[model samples]
Target: MANKAVKVGLLGLGTVGGGVARLLMEKRAELSAYLGVDLQLARAVDLEPARAEELGLAPGVFSSDSWSILEDGDIDIVVETVGGLEPARAMVLTALNKGKGVVTANKALLASHGVEIFQTARQQGVGIAFEASVGGGIPLVRSLRDSLAANRVTSCLGILNGTCNFILSRMTAEGAPFDQVLAQAQEKGYAEADPTFDVEGTDTAHKLAIVASLVTGAQPRLDDIPTEGITKITPLDIQFAGEFGFKIKLLAVLNNQGGKVEARVHPALVPHDHLLASVEGPFNALHVNGDWVGQVLLYGQGAGRRPTASAVVGDVLELARDVAAGVPGRVPPLGTQASGGRRLDLAPLDDARCQYYCRFAALDQPGVLASVARELGSFNISIEKVTQKGRQEAGPVPIVMLTHEAREADLRGALKKIDALPEIVEPTVVIRMA
Candidate 1:
């Protein structure tokens, strides 16, 4: 008997796809030795075959038609880096139905349709690997699913989006406004021309959903998670946070209390000495708290051709090893139970309890501070400390307060009444303290 070759096929020739192809070829001999099989790049599918030439791949190895890979019986694994929702989903599902393993970095597609996709893999008796879907090159997903498998994950907090982190870091460093920092991020290519997805917290929310599923066995509804962007963050808030020994970063947090889960994405005031606060620039860091393992922090480049591709290829090797072992679906898609029977209730953001940082632009009237305090008391929200400077400014004075731990609903109601006061000149800025 001879050792059969494990054939691989790629569905996209973009940055990540190119990197995967390059790494696969470069490390072919070592990977083959480790897996105990001849690993081959059977073929690659791309809309523009000319792009394949740039990667220095032979003509026969790259094809414009996707069917050549998806329908090929010899291709044991299908890697879908084409991204987007449509063709990626269709290709992955097709490959699984044909008894081929799948590896993907399409976070949007999985976050949206993961339940159905994972169930399909189970039905087909094949495994689906999505290591690159969250945290880029960092092995957060695998660690949570495998290494920390013994302990129960209590809470997950992360600066998941690098673009927003970079923008916020710049604002904190240079005392720049949101608009100015965003423009600088675009110039540096850290952010896209239209960075709404990354800046608005949608990208972080998607990654959180995937993380929540692995932490718990339930596939959460993406639309149900409360999300808030960093667009409203200003240098004033940054300065105030620094004064309070804190830094502001957009955070994707998931808490599993008993069986109830609370998932949200928003800008939070992290203590200056906290590990997450120290994670600056375009780098990402995820903090997971488990019963036995305690707190674990994984930090690295969150995205780019090389980092993302590294994760994608890591998944490929994992699935390849599974195929060789003859235990393809041994590990569940959600990393625990094959049947997602656990249905955890989603916690409403209004019910969450946390400290708050409040700022008000007031008319500097003697009773203005008293009025704000009284309004907050009306909602049963207590202030921990209040800072008001009596400078001889022409306009309204800035009144900043740090409130004790209070219900989110109560803070919202208090802010509504406070903003309605005649002395308040502009909208109140309220950031949650982590």
Candidate 2:
């Protein structure tokens, strides 16, 4: 059996899929040598027939039908890079039921339907490896599941989306507006044509839900997380953040409070000297705090063809080793066996307490500052620092304030009242402090 080849079928021939195929084909000899068995790319399935010619796959290996690989008894593992919900979800379930080990980079599928997926794998006695799902080549899932297994993880803060990070980084460095930097990002292929998922914080939220599920052993619904995008972030806010000794970043945060979890994604003002603040461009960083291990920072190129493909192949090799050894479920997919059944109590955002950076555009009139402050005071929100910019004789000016720790509900209440005042012209912008 040691001499037998562990066959793999790849679904999708897009950017990530092409990279996976190239890595498997190019590194075939080395991988087979390392695993002590032939790791072969048995089939590659895609809708476009031209992709097969483009990737230069072996004549019999490329097919338009996914079932050719899924139904093939010889194939031991199926790697799904076809993102989004519909067919990817259906294909993954079918692969697991067939008792074939699966490796995928579909974070959205996992985030939304992970419990069902994990349960299927467990019942089938086959493993599902997703090392590339979250932090690309950073080895985040394996680290959290294996390296930090002994510790009770208390918190995890991450710069999870590379597109958002890239846009924000350019905005900070060039002092450009969001639209300008986003346009540049699309031109450079750092963002998708429709960047809603990344910019709207849904992508980051998906990753956060996965990470939080690993920590809490319960999968939280994607809709439950309070997510705020960076589209509203302006150069003015970025400048104000810098003035306050901070940098603005789209952050995914998960805090385990006595078994209850707080999962949120938003633009947070991180301290200038912090590790996460320094992570610029398309890079991603995750700061995980464990009860026993304290704090650990993981940084790397979060997403790309090479980095993500490297992670996908790593999972393939790991599963290949198990397949060769005739041990399919050697390691639990989520590091622990309690994942599918455990329930996590997710705390609402209203209960969350944190410092805030608030910007109010109000008319340059006397009593404006006091009126805003009095509203905040009534709701038990206290300002630690305040600055007013652009003294206009007939127009609204920016009034920025940094407040001490306050409950989210109170802050929202205060802001609601403050915005209704006659002196206030535009809605207040509020960003939480990390």
Candidate 3:
């Protein structure tokens, strides 16, 4: 029989999109031989036509109108690297509805409107592969969906955002303030000019929602996840964390608590010996705990053109093989049958229990520690260690404390009462312990 021909259409020609195009075109012969199908880069759509010239794509391959690719009957798969909700979502849905397979790295779109997209793909009997959405080239989604499918995943703790991880790692290494490190990250292209999503924990939360949904078979609302950023972390906090034998990281935490799932993103204090503590600088790590697998750590470059494109192309080839065989939906978008797994409820943040690192700026008075301790004790929060460093004759001094495991509600209540005290000068800084 003649080898089936599978054509791929690219929706964007930006950094990641360009990489995907280059790979698909450069490795066409090898890919075709591997899959026993003629894998072709059929069409590329981007607002900037100059991108095609820059990438040296053939004359007829580039088009300004997206409909050329979307409406093209020969294209068997659509690769959407357009990173947003509006046009990308609409375009992806259109492709799936047309029975064309999809490959995307849009974490935000997947996290926000995944149910509708997955349903559309399922109804059309096509597939949607999104390996690059979460951990760049780490293969995390596939590992969770295929490799660890036999094990019941109990928890997932990840350093999901490369921008945030870079900032935090710099802060820890140089003892620089948050603002300075963030500025450096932006200058180095690690962060955006307006990095609200990455710095404020929203980016990590989006990735967490996707991973949690895959683990529990329930689509979690992005707003439901409590997100905390690294904006307030200072050099003093990093120094104090080191003194306590811990390193600070912005972590995306997802735990399957009985039938309820706990999801949150925030700066966390990880012990020095823990594997996650060693993950630094534009790197990503996911520590997944499964009943049978015990503990699995998937670590790699979280983002960038080549790494992200590597994942996107891998998904393209996988979906291409299925397309060539005329067998779509061989594997569901999220790894499980849409209606197969039980939906898990989201656990409230208030009920979360963990040790905490609290920093208080208070008047350099002898009675300040006693007053703060009394308030924390009132909420049933016990301190495991306390350190009062440096005395500012006129300004407030630093009081850092490490607390035993306590409910988040009780800790918040204690901090609220303590912040209201006459001796306290600034709001408390709380970093959860892993």
Number of clashing residue pairs in every model? 0, 0, 0
- Model 2 is weakest, by summed lDDT over 10 consecutive residues, at 337-346
* Candidate 3 vs. true structure, TM-score: 0.97
Query: What is the alpha-carbon lDDT of model 3 when measured against the actual structure?
Result: 0.91
Compared with the true structure, what per-residue lDDT tens digits does model 2 show for residues 183-226?
99999999999999999999999999889878877889888999
Cα lDDT computed for each candidate against the true fold: 0.89, 0.92, 0.91
Residue 358, model 3: lDDT of: 94
Q: Positional deviation of 197 in candidate 1, in angstroms?
A: 0.6
**TM-score of every model versus the real structure:** 0.97, 0.98, 0.97
For TM-score, candidate 1 versus 2, the one ahead is 2
- Rank list by TM-score: 2, 3, 1
